[model samples]
Target: MNNYNLNHLKELESEAIYVLREVASQFQNPAILFSGGKDSIILTHLALKAFYPAKIPFPLVHIDTGHNFPETIKFRDDIVDRLGARLIVGSVQNTINDGKVREESGRDASRNALQTVTLLDAIEENKIDCAIGGARRDEEKSRAKERFFSHRDEFGQWNPKHQRAELWNLFNGRMNSGEHFRAFPISNWTEMDVWQYILSEGIDVPSLYIAHNREVVWRNNTWLPYSDLIKLRPEEEIVEKLVRFRTLGDITITGAIESGADSLTKVVVEVASSRQTERGNRSDDKRSETSMEDRKRLGYF
Candidate 1:
């Protein structure tokens, strides 16, 4: 090892920047999946730093489940406007109307699973061969098996067992026609790494991550954000609670935790000693032991 001081966060940033550039050089049409989440915000920040004088070469693709938080959508639009990056939205509701995927039924109904169809459709419609996502290995068990350059079949399905070997920083993005890649620049970064980077870089994330008073309902062992999309069960009455979301997604499925960490400093402390995974509140993953894997196989990011 070199005798110089080692800064892990800076090292991670450098690696992510290198991966972003690699995607730019390798793919014909590449886009970043931006959701105004902390991870994607970091991706955007790095992309800005990577190619400073030039505008971001790729567009930002958002797959609208139609259940997104109002704050998230507003932040997304604001960032795209500020950065002058092109935005592409693929609507799950449109996919449903087109008879591609149907909405779920019963009390456990959610549009979370239907997002895969919209994502695949968006990739096909936009002719995007490479999609840069803000997926971290520490976020989920299934994601822990991902590569920096993850391969997808012609149908956009992922076979986790059959991944390309990224040895010594040499990434192989070779794919046949109709095939594409899901490249994760920060796959190696942990939750703490992201928090530290955000704090250090002073990046802005959506307001949901910070603790605030919101009307929520207790469901499926977690606090569900109150929204028009969430049908209030007779017994499930909405109550005001001070909560924050660990992960952001469809209002019906994404779960929130009771927190008092209002600032970034408090958030760092909260994340440091947290016993559960960052995605522990995501009810979509609670469907089964291999739910994430199953979704990934079906082309869910």
Candidate 2:
């Protein structure tokens, strides 16, 4: 116990930096999945710090559901431009137009589940051998079992039970042709750690996290934002509420929590004291007990 004086945050930062460097050194065509979310922003910032004086080695990949928040899109483009990194968008609209996937019909239907197809399409089209994401173990039970270097089959399907052993950070990145890997540099990080890291690093994120007044409707025990994709019920009346998004996704599925935590410190405090998980706001995951698992098996991230 005497030698445990090292800061845990610093240790996590070191590990993430190591993982970033490993991706650069190992993969031929790698890219970071940037969604303009807080986690992605932190991941991108760490990548820049990992290779200072040298630009990020890989491009940024975003699977646009065509239902993202306007602020998120603006922030995404701004970050890419500032970082001088290439941005590739895999649009769900293109997938629908090409008949690759059909749009869901219903008030609860969302494009969140459909993102996997666009993501896989982007990977194949770009010939990307590795995709670094901001996925964290604490976000969901399925993600808890993920490795820092999670391998995917030729079809981009994940086999949790058959995953390769990662002992003492000795990652085995070997994979056959047509097979790629999803690397989570911040796999061990928790929501609290993410907020703390963002505060420490002064990373910029979308304004949706901060409290703002918006016209919302109470549905499915969560506050659903008013969107063209959402169908209104006669009983569910829209009202102005001070709310903030805990997690960003397809506008129809992502829920907002009533909050007044406008600043980063306040946000961190809120997360630290909250009893519910971050994904609690994601209606897509609420559809089934194994929703995330089922989606991940089909190449969802």
How much RMSD separates candidate 1 from the native structure?
A: 1.4
149: Cα error in model 2, Å: 0.6
Candidate 2: lDDT of 114? 83
lDDT scores of the candidates, listed in order = 0.91, 0.91
Candidate 1's C-alpha runs over 4 A off are 1-3
| lDDT by residue for model 2 (1-301), tens | 5786658888899999999999988899999999888889999999998999899989999999989888999999999899999999999999999999999887677888889999999999999999999999989989899999999999999998899989998778889999999999999898899989888878888889988998898998899898777778889888899999989887888889999998989999999999888889888999899999999998998
Compose the digit string of candidate 1's lDDT tens values, residues 36-96.
7888999999999888889989999999988889999999999999999999999999999
TM-score of each: 0.97, 0.97
